[model samples]
Target: MGSVQRAMRLLETVAAHERGAPAKQLARQAGLALPTTYHLLRTLVHEGYLRRDSGLFHLGDAAERLSRRVARQRRRSAVTETLAHWHDVIGAPLYCARYRDGEIEVVGVADSQENPAVGEWADFRATGHAHAIGQCLLSQLDEEARRDHLARHPVQSLTPYTVEDEGAFLRRLAAARHGEPVLERQEYALGTVCAAIPIRIGTIVATVAVSLPVHQADQLLPTAHRLQAEIGRAPGVLALSFSI
Candidate 1:
């Protein structure tokens, strides 16, 4: 395979293995000969894409920095526009989120309507389990990737309404995979209801949703439909651009 392809494969291998794979194991998984794998890994390490700890390899600070940059870049003017559109149409707080590593991070938010309950800025490392954004993004992953992600970071209950059991969470994910939007009610915060639709690109990347208070959400079905329709029409524009 070409160097670029090999590098991508190596990254995937590293991502798939949670504990940081040994050099020999990474080489075997990447299908590269031992010597070539070692050389490629060394080069990657030098370039700040991979880090070596003791004898195992993991993503380096450079890789994390790049990921954050990409994620920030994904929050384009279009995303801001989308958030604004949702805010105006729904008349409630609207936010855009994307999944990174095993967590969901909020990259953009619009607050045309005031809600004392929801904060302007979301916690950076907050779990995705209690929101539609996270569920929709998780739905986009394949079975193996989904399993790997859940294995790395098991679902946590953030509220009384949150899915606290594995089977129920899997069922919800299955529904999301079938193109159903997940409605989370006071799962992340009391008195908040979130409706999320999978913003899909071709078949992989997902990024779209509008969260509002339950009363506000009740008035937002039409607006939400419009948002979902708009997102469906321009899935690639957001997914390809945002990637942290």
Candidate 2:
């Protein structure tokens, strides 16, 4: 364990130098003996953790891959925490979703026993035509992308309020104004209404949505507007590409 710690220390020292550093400088900085540093550097090069070029050591591909994995994990954790915070602030079930590689994915959801989330009785990906979250994400996509998605998942009446057919759904999507929340009334689930606002960050298509019971439908628009404003202030919540 002590040897591993020494090796990690050396690696960190090497990383501090953008142009790389020589063995003697690395040893002095890491407080390791000259001989110990040489031995550990040789082992690191062999294990693909470091690469030596012109007598200077630099981080290798393995170290870079590890860094990327840790960064992604941190971003995913932040997204989850943000969703839970928003759920408490909005007093409704909160959902965060995105369009990745032509598929709708619900990345994070926050709910509790009191204000429980809607049950996923049916698959969300295939039922994109019948929900505010899906419609909002689709609205952000270009014409070809939207048509391609509908081609794979044909429009169907999941409830009395769902769009009737592909043509009507296409028209509805076209008529939707940009930068406005997509609203649905018990279209995806019985006795539930939802509103979704796009979280437009570059090319990544994402949405932040909230759902309330049909009886409390009047709160949908105001709640959605609040969510939009909150999301705008903390754009980091969706600034990452956890999916694509």
Candidate 3:
């Protein structure tokens, strides 16, 4: 890979580890030789991309600033505009979320109609198995990562419809990975049903969902499918995309 790509990769590696990984560990994880890793770390430390403390390297303040800048830019991205259009077309709450460092964060949301749960948008974090967006992103992870994530955060019963068992959760995730949207009825909330589809740049990278009252979800499926197709056609709607 080129120098810029390598540097970005190293930055991401540090961000992922968070606790300042050692040079040997960083080198092994990043597929670089010891000498190269040391040089890269030194350069990055000097350039304010990383910081060295007690022989371990952590992301510096500059890296955090860059991350916030990227998050702000993504909030204003074209994909978010398209998401708003989808929300308008469907008449339900639509959200765009991405998986970052083992958590799914809602980056964009649109709600034109008033709903009891619409305001919950700002509070939604994809860290729990009760969320459709979280499950969809988890479905994209490899087996080991998926298992580890589940172990770290076991399923909690949120409502009568919540999947409280590990086996069922895995089954639902498998179905979601096969392009089937997982629908939860009152699982996330008493009256809510959420249907989510994985969004990809090339494969699975994020998730977009339409959430509404359980009674309304059936009626909204057609509109949701139409919106989904439009999203699939929109340029750069996903973090990954297949070029035709």
Candidate 4:
């Protein structure tokens, strides 16, 4: 076998043992000569792909990082597919966002040619006060954190409908009852209306939102309700919220 194949065999053998495997045991399990196993093990250790402890070998930091990356990609794919499925079902653009590290992040969006998403003419991060995602995320934070975020990103009127008064905005946020989606009309964009509902998965706090052009403004809340129901049923796709 090639050196790479031999090395992979050794790695697979090492991974099969939870408590780690001695070089001789690894050689036997991998069907490699003892000297070849030692050489590959030394190289793997030097490259941070394997850890050696008292003559036993185990997967190392690099392997863990690779596994995490793979898991994150899988979750991202699942989220994208789920969004696309609902975009087709609801016939509107779908958006996913998260409140992480005190910032609003739009992680995924699904749209089609017939039902395109609203153009992001302005930076979403800087204009969280104006968008459904940002408003919904802000609503989930405690009063102190919410005030701190507003201090940093101060709410400003993006359009005529945008909430300009900080006190009024805070009151509006407080008024949104639990299990209700936050809705906004032509506030962030001149021609689009959106709605978002908070999603909590373990320690993760995120939002699933939908947007439609002004002509279809009446459908925003209904679309959001459908999205909330779909999300409630398919919680597994959101397990990677932190990864994105």
Q: Pick the lDDT winner.
A: 2
| TM-score against native, each model | 0.59, 0.92, 0.63, 0.94
Report the candidate with higher TM-score, 1 versus 2. 2
Poorly placed runs, candidate 4 (over 4 Å): 240-244
lDDT per residue for candidate 2 within 54-172, as digits (tens), equals 99999998888888888888888888899888888888999999999899999889998889999888899999999999999998888899999999999887888888998888888
Position 133, candidate 4: lDDT: 89
Best by TM-score: 4
Q: What is the C-alpha lDDT of each candidate?
A: 0.70, 0.91, 0.72, 0.87
Superior by TM-score: candidate 2 or candidate 3: 2
Q: Model 4 — which ten-residue stretch has the worst lDDT?
A: 235-244
The CA lDDT at 154 in model 1 is 70
Per-residue lDDT of 1-61 in model 1, one digit per residue for the tens?
A: 5988988899889878777999899888788899978888999999999989989999988
- Candidate 4, 214: how far from true, in Å? 0.6
After superposition, which runs of candidate 3 have C-alpha atoms over 4 Å from their true positions? 1-77, 113-127, 240-244
Could you arrange the candidates by lDDT from highest to lowest? 2, 4, 3, 1
* lDDT for each residue of candidate 3 in 3-85, tens digit (9 for 90 to 100): 77778877878888867899899888888778988888899999898999999899998888888777667646666677778
